[model samples]
Target chain A: MLVSTARLHSVLKTAVDGIIVIDDSGTVLVFNDACVHLFGYERDEVIGKNVSILMSEDDAKSHDAHIKRYLDTGEKRIIGQGREVSGCHKDGSPIPIELSVGEADTSEGHQFIGIIRDLRARKAFEQRVRDLQSNLVVMTRVNALDEMGAAIAHEINQPLTAVMLYLQTAARRMKTLEEQDPQLLSIMTRAVDEADRASKIIQRMRSFVEKQEPQKVGVNLASLIDECVELVMLGHKNDNINVISNFSDHDYNLTVDAIQVQQILVNLIRNACEAIKDCKKQEVYVDVDIAATDVFIKVTDTGPGLCEEVREQLFKAFTGTKRRGLGVGLAISRSIAQNHGGDLFVEPYVKGKGATFVLRLPLGLDGADGQSNLASASMI
Target chain B: MIHVIEDDFSVRDALQHLFTELGASSCTYSDAESFLNFLKQVTAKDCVLVDLHLPGISGVEVIKYLRELSDPPHIVAITGKSLAEINKAFTGIKRPPIVRKPLKEECLLREMDLGTALNSA
Candidate 1:
C-alpha cells in the first residue's frame, strides 16, 4: 500500500525518536518534532542550519571532513550502520545518544536521514546494573574469604595444638629423667613456645573468621586486655611504639565473649599501629576504666587523625583507611562490642593529634540481648 | 597393641610416643590406605586411633569397613574438627568415641585404656 506524501510526513513528524534529513552539503532540510524537542531547537531554527550544529564540538569539527571523504570515495562508513555517539544539547552539555543514518536517492539529489535515540536514561540504568553486579561480586568474594579462613584456622590449629601439647609432655618427661641436659631442655622449651605462637596465630584467624557462637562468660577485663595487647604488640616492639596500659584496679569482671573481645582489641591495636606508622614519636595508650554499670577500654594512638572520608564510614564494613586493610576489621570489632550489650565508637578525632577508639561493655546482662550470639566477624 | 592413622607427622609420632609410654605396643600409618592394608593381618583386642581427616578413603570409611568384619578392632575417631561435624558421617552405624586433638595426654590415655579394657572384657 502506497501512502500519500502528506500522510507520511505527518507520521514522521510524530515519531518517538528524533529524525532529521540533510542534503548533500550537510544542510538540514527536514526536522521532525522529536528532533526539535531533542536538540532543544525550533523547526524553523534548524531547517536551513548546518547539521554539524547538533554534534559535539569534536564531532562537529570532523563531521564535514567525514562527509567530504564519503562523497569523494563513494564509500559508506557509518551511513548504514548504527553507532553510539555524543550529541550537543542546546544547554551545551553533551548527551549520549544512539544514531542510525540511512541515505536515499531523492529526485532533488542525495539526502541522509538520521534516527537519534536519547540514551541518558538507558545508560544510567545500565550503569546502575553494573554497580549492583560488582557489589554482589565483592560480597561473595568476602564471604568466600571468611569460609576459607575458617577452614585454614581449623586445619593449622590442629597440628599446632598437637605440637604444643607434645612438647610440653616431652619437657615434663625430660625433667623427670635423671641428669636431664639443660641445653636440650632449653631447646625443647623454645620449640614449645614456637608451637604456642603458631597456635595463637591460628586462634587469631579463627576469632576473626567468627564462624562459631560467642561463648559468653564472666572473664577478668584487665587480663583479657593485657592478653590482647601482648598478642598485637608481639614482633611490633622494635617499631619504637610505646604501648602504655593503664588499668583501674577495680574489679571489672564482665560476662562477654573473651575471644571476640580479644579480636576487637587486636584490630584496634593493629589499626592504631598503622595510623602511627609515619609518626616520629609513636605511642599507643590503652586505658581501662570500670564504671557502675559498664567497663570502658579506650585505645588511643598518636598519629595523623582520621580524614573526612574515613570518619564518615568508619564503622562501615569494607571501608578501611589502610592501604592493604580488608576494611571489615572495624566493622566486625564494633559489631562484637555491640553484641556484648555495649558499643564501639571513635572519639571525635583531633587533627595533627591522633584518634581514640572507645569500647564499652555492660557490667550486667540486663541490656544484653541475644544479638551478641550472631556472627560478628569477617575475613580478608 | 594399637594402630594410629594420622596424616600429620608430628602428631602421629606424638601419639606413638604416648602409647609407648603408657606401656602399649602400637603402629603408626600416615594415611588410611596403609592402615587398611595393615588391617588384613590385624587381630581383635587391638585399637585403631584413626584421624577423621585423611588422604584416601577417609577415617569414616575406614571405620565403616572395620565394622563390617566379624571381629573388627575397636575404632576410635581422632579429630581436630568438632564432634558434631564428624557425627554426620556415623549415621545408621555404630559411632566411635571421638577424641579431640591437640590431644591432651589424660584424655587420650583414658580413651585408649577404656577401649583396650572394653575389648579384653
Candidate 2:
C-alpha cells in the first residue's frame, strides 16, 4: 500500500497540469511539482499556506467567501466546471490560467482539488491566427479594389477620349471662323464644360475606390444612374441589352456617399446585363422613386429569374452565378449601401419573368429615422 | 489621302475637321464593311485611320482583311483602349502604328508625316 501510494503521488506530481489540494478551511494541504513550476513557488512555500496566495488580490479576497457559500449551500459552481482566471506567480505577476475544481470527502475533512492549465501559449497562438485571418481579408479586399480601379479607368477613359476629340474639333472650327461668333464661342465653352464633367466623373470613381472613408454630399439621382449605365456599357458593344432609366421628377436629391451609392448601381446594372445575356430581346429597366422618408432605386431584369437555389442565398458572398471572376461584387455593393444607411435585396422572382433588386436608402435632413423594409414581396 | 473609319459620328466628324485643320484631305466611313468595299476598287496612296470599335466588322478585322491585299494602305489604329486589348489582332501581319485617343494633333501629324517620308524613301 505504501509503494502504491508513492507511485500515485509521483504520477500526480509529474502531470502536465498544476494540481493543488486545499482543506475545507481554504488552507493548502498539497502542492504538486507542476504547481510549483507554474506559480514559480517551491512546494514547501505553498504546501502549508492558504491557496488564496496563488490568486490575484481580487480573486484572493473572494476565495474564502466562495468556499463558505459552497459549504453552506452544498452547491457546486466552479467545483465541476473549468473557468478562466488569473493566477499570481511568486514574483507577483499575473498570468492567465484555466482552472477546474473538484470536491473530495477525505477522511480528515472535505477538500477541494484544482487542476490549473497555463493559457499563455494558447492565447498567443489564437492572437497569431487572428492576425493572419485579418491580413488575408485585407489582401482579398485590395485585389478586388485593384480590379475595380481598372474597370473604372476603362469606363472613364471612353468619355475623356470623346471630350478631347470634341474640344479639339471645336478649337479647330473656332480658328476657321472669320470672326468668333457668340454661338460658336458658347458651343466651345459648353464642350469644355462637358470635358470637365467627364474628368469629374473619373475623379469621383478614383476617389471611391482609393479613399477608405465615404464622403457624403447631395447628389441628383438622374445623373448618378446615367453614370452607372455609362460605366456598365463601356466595353460591352454587341450584346444588345436595352437599358431604360426612369428618374423621379423632383431630382430625388439626398446627402449620401455618392460614389459608393454609384457602385451599388453599377453592380446591379451589370448583374442585370449578365442575367439577360441569353435572351434575344434583352432589357434592364432602372426606376428611381422618392418615398416620404426614403429613396428607392429598383433594377428590373427580363432574364430567366433567379432559380430556387440562387434566390435562397441571393445576397450571400460568393453566391453569384457569373461565369467569370469573383462573385464578391453584389456582396460588397450591398455592404456599401448598408454602410451609407441603406439596404440592398432582391425582390421575389415573378412567375412569368424578370427579377428586381431594390436598393432603399434613407433620406431626410437628419437621415437617422429611415428604415428599410426587409420583406421580399415580388412573388405575385 | 487619310481614310477614317469610326462608328461614333461625333468622333469621326472631329477627326475629319482636325485632319482638314492640319492640311490633310480625309474621307470618313462609319464602319469597316464600307471601307473594305471602297478598298476593293480604289487606287490611291492613302493612310487608314481606324477606330478599334465599330458597328459591323471591327477595325482589327479590317486590318486582317487588308493584309491579304497586294498593296494594303499604311494602317494607323486609333483607340481609347490599351494596345494590349487589341494586340491579338496583329499576330501574323506586320503590326500597324497605334495612336491612343483623345487624339493629340502633333503626335498624329508626326506619325502620318513619318509614314509619308518612309513611303517616299
Q: Name the top lDDT candidate.
A: 1
- Model 1 CA deviation exceeding 4 Å by range: A1-18, A22-95, A100-112, A117-133, A136-162, A180-194, A207-380, B38-44, B69-74, B80-95, B100-102, B114-121
Docking class of 2: incorrect
Q: Is the docking of candidate 1 incorrect, acceptable, medium or high quality?
A: incorrect
Backbone N/Cα/C clashes per model:
0, 0
Which candidate leads the pack in DockQ? Answer: 2
Overall local distance difference test of candidate 2? 0.73
Where in model 2 is the C-alpha error above 4 Å? Answer: A3-7, A132-151, A170-182, A193-380, B1-121
Give the 10-residue window scoring lowest on summed lDDT in candidate 2 chain A: A371-380
Error of 2 at B89 (Å): 14
DockQ, every prediction:
0.13, 0.19
True contacts kept of 2: 0.33
Query: Per-residue lDDT tens digits of candidate 1, residues A138-185?
Result: 644564466456555665656665676677778878887899799999
